[model samples]
Target chain A: MSEGPGAKVYVFDAYGTLFDVHSAVARHRETIGPSADRLSELWRTKQLEYSWVRSLAGRYRDFWSLTEDALDFAAAKIGGIAPEARATLLDAYRALDAYPEIREVLGELKAQGASIAILSNGSPAMLDAGVSAAGIGDLLDDVLSVDELEVFKTDPRTYALVTRRFGVTAEDVSFQSSNRWDIAGAKAFGFRCAWINRAGAPDEYAELTPDRTLCDLRGLLDASE
Target chain B: MSEGPGAKVYVFDAYGTLFDVHSAVARHRETIGPSADRLSELWRTKQLEYSWVRSLAGRYRDFWSLTEDALDFAAAKIGGIAPEARATLLDAYRALDAYPEIREVLGELKAQGASIAILSNGSPAMLDAGVSAAGIGDLLDDVLSVDELEVFKTDPRTYALVTRRFGVTAEDVSFQSSNRWDIAGAKAFGFRCAWINRAGAPDEYAELTPDRTLCDLRGLLDASE
Candidate 1:
């Protein structure tokens, strides 16, 4: 059975799902130089790796720290990423260019009376920087961070924080996360999550499949009606 | 103080360290046909992803089951891979043709009379498949699995299990794990670890630098003796 329409709150996962971190790097490819794509891939791989390892070791550091550290590691290996590029690159994350159709999709959803929020794993400062840079603040109701929870998205407490902040029943909230793991966690926690298959990948965990899977927010909101 | 050369057992992680499972698809490129690289990459990526995701979510499935499931998931998206090809692709993993220099290196280590063992995250059944196929059962002193501990490696208990089984103190052993996190966890548990930098990659976690880092087993065993 489909989750009822009362789940009107559209919570978007900020990275990869809404903001194309890849595009952010692509825009600065000239500055990132020959290792641009490699740098981006390495940074992304490192970014995720740090989170899981740190979490496992019970060594907690916020996402921004992890992101910058990962970039620095990638930079040292492939020379020519200037200090200025760091600011521009780091600054670019907050203002990351949305997928070409994102704004329009959000507009359509809001027009139909849905609340959109950014519930990201990004640190507060980092999330603010990206959301402001991309001009997504106007469309989002709240930019929730996992910083306070001292945990990452899959942790039950991480999603519970969002539920408490929004005052919505877990199942009545339309949680969207780009990561299959996040989607799995939300589904397991009773949230009506929409897995944004941006990479066109399937969730491997059969026990925790999302209620709905979509290509993007457009499909998510459109499906509700 | 250096770890004395007295009774220093080298517990080598079997899968990525000595064996390369990537060939599971690469060798069967003919059967994989088109999109061979992509299919192989997805299979490998999903296998690792499933391990980490399943580990974090407190959902435990043996590496064997997860490996097959990941292949099935990837195959489904890659033009519906034939069952026969899937079987052949997996058969390659049975032996995982060791790296070109692995056998000679193992021979050299044996020549030096170093204590050798296979410590892996694979269950007993899975470990037996790979070990017997490669005919390395005679080369290794003891084949250790996380099964006895009922926990995967990178867990402190996993490292302890190996050390405890060998009846040697953690310092009396040099742990070898190609995985950055595995090295980190092994080091955290106070095992002197030699990270095989097979990828020549930078350290994933800056905090967990190995006691000894080397290009491969030859360098590791040679440097110690």
Candidate 2:
């Protein structure tokens, strides 16, 4: 099949979609024991929930602080993590490794002339750390953080950063996220979305569909095609 | 206990705090089959997630529509609910059973000279149906729907409705919810909060604590005492 008109800008959600958020907890599995996965799940749940809650309340806390807060809540449930272990896990978060396919996918998008970027709730410092740590900082054209607006993702204003910075309409932007809610929100905000369902989870949001569904970044190129 | 200086207004969260949200699915457990609990869990999760997502995006659909949309999403995950069964479930939702303690607590609060009201993301119609069905309409001084603001709760503006309607500061309003997020939001917005932890779940939001933690409405009286 012929390649359709390519997107002007391709925006990727940073945390679970690109960087493996669970990696931090997984790296310390020996210390965390069997509850590693459960703790990771709860930590992620609280992290996102806090972002939404803070956004709704119009009280913005940077993602780094929010992540720490989520970890505190999750640690409490699992009978707590040692301070040294907690420090190690949090340090690992700032340098979360990208999924195996991320670099190649970004290369392809760049070769195809799509201006690739990240729009995340991560603070500028955290995003910088992740991008540099993953060695992909040179590949991205821009990094947008909701910290500028003191809000979190799924907020239309947060998504508008892409349009303003890239000089493209929402439709001209192709946004990808592993999050069903993020996909729905981006679709509702008029972006051409590619939902990266890495976990093969059932679709749990109605009325809105991403323009594309990819099992991984490898499928992103095909979806764009 | 001398009522300890009764609050100017007692604002309750409608869905899980006052009405049992799972009652609709529970009523038709046979129809929902083995997935009854799972379906109910997903429905409630999606319902709240949609409200927060919509509010963040500034695209507000009434909670009634959001509820149906959430059900659609939930049913899809559970392999879909038939139209007739779906109708039955939705209809049942309109008249959810109030928690056994709700009426008695409202009566006690009223007798103590505290203004009792509901502040929910529910559309006025849904609140009306539940209130009327439960025969507690007369006990409530006012029903505040976030529909007027076209936003969901946790948005400080939604909580501001209490102050606007009752001519009271947030400190004078005692807000209660079974949802931890609601309690945290209310606390952050400056309301004296009572978190009805009916399920005894761990408090996931950090730093913000409810003024009272009650197993049920019976404890509300004691908390005041």
Candidate 3:
């Protein structure tokens, strides 16, 4: 309830929250015609693998590089990745389509005059590409990364960065992520977290239950005030 | 390798590392009935979910309780879990077979005069049951848990505990797991990690590459020297 206009800040999780990322892989199913869903699953799994690996190796790269690396690796599986398709894959990332309600939700949150920022595992470049592609860059105060934390999402330190960056108690911030684990991470770190279970991921962990569950960002925004 | 004789510890990851865990659900495939390994997949997915959720909610139970919760949840999916079957489902855990080489490899590791231990995400009871059931309890010097770490395996602290307890740097310890991400995590935290890729997880993560890959623990011990 303290999250009204005067609330310290409202931290938003990117990836699953503001973006239709599952559609990225699902799109490959439609676009590739042969590999279809296989490509999508490979891309998603490899993408997560890259981010996690890069974080562990102390080799910080923008998420753009990681995604391309993942796509290339996955492409190597069914058949060799065509040089052309790799470029298309990168383009697909920057051109990621926002969920139907994301733009409206961002606009509404902005109109409310609340401080809004993004806490994402995506590298700055990737975040830039996603927001630019979605046309919601102006709505974000800034995009943050676990790169700063030297780890990936679901690390409490990654969540700590949000409140520490804002100089407020975790209660002063409301974190949102479509990934249940990320939501668990934020809640475990004591943030008032909202889980946007767009895919209806079954409950996995305990204690860090989402203070609120929403079908999408618009649902989050609707329920926030 | 700063770990002296007393300092060096071989921390075995439980689920896929030492114990043939899928057999737990694989045994239930008749009741859950194999949609071609659906039960194993569901059990694993739920176990992970329960672990993360319990950690978040601060309702900390040992991994055994969570395992039962996950089994019941997954069992409910294909059909109702009967009380008798629930007992059987859990009994499967206490009597899981070891990976073919686990017995030989663990015996070799211990015979080589290395301090051995289990670092697992399981509740204390589950870890105990798995180790005793696998018939390798005597081979392990100690068992570690997120119960003490207050975080799950992927957290750096989870790895940190073993190093600190054994008084070794992450550089000296050789951590192993069947889970690709857990290996990725140990490597991320700067531990020497081996992927016991029983299910054949590919090296898709370009950054978090394993220092070594082996078909089984025997290969791990063979490669160690």
| Top candidate when judged by lDDT against the true structure | 2
User: What is the per-residue lDDT of model 1 for residues A1-225, given as tens digits with 9 covering 90 to 100?
Assistant: 232456477788888887887776898998877899989987886787666666655566899888888888788778648889988888776677777777888777777677778887799988887777666678777788889877666657777876787777786688877788778777777888788887887556888888888887678656753
lDDT of 1 by residue, B1-225 (tens): 233457667788988888886777778888778888878777876776666555555567888887788888888768678879878877777768676666677667767777778888787887888878777777788888876654465657777877677777888788887777788888878889889888787666777779888887778646854
Question: How is the predicted docking of candidate 2 categorized under the CAPRI scheme?
Answer: medium
Against the reference, the lDDT scores of all candidates come to 0.76, 0.88, 0.71
Give the lDDT of residue B190 in candidate 3. 87
Regarding DockQ, does 2 or 3 come out ahead?
2
Off by over 4 Å in 1: A1-9, A31-39, A72-87, A100-116, A138-141, A164-169, B1-6, B33-35, B73-82, B100-115, B147-153, B167-169
Full ranking by DockQ: 2, 1, 3
Reference interface contacts recovered per candidate = 0.19, 0.72, 0.07
Ten residues in a row with the worst lDDT in model 1 chain B?
B1-10
| TM-score, candidate number 2 | 0.88
Model 1, residue B35: C-alpha shift (Å): 4.2
* Every candidate's TM-score, chain A alone: 0.87, 0.95, 0.86
- Residue range B1-225, candidate 2, lDDT tens digits: 122454568899999999999999999999889999989988998888889988887778899998998898889888888889989999999999899988889999899888989999999999999999888998999999999999898999899999888888899888999999999889889999989999877776667789889998788787663
Best by TM-score: 2
Between candidates 1 and 3, name the one with more favorable lDDT: 1
How far residue B187's Cα lies from its native spot in candidate 2, in Å, is: 2.3
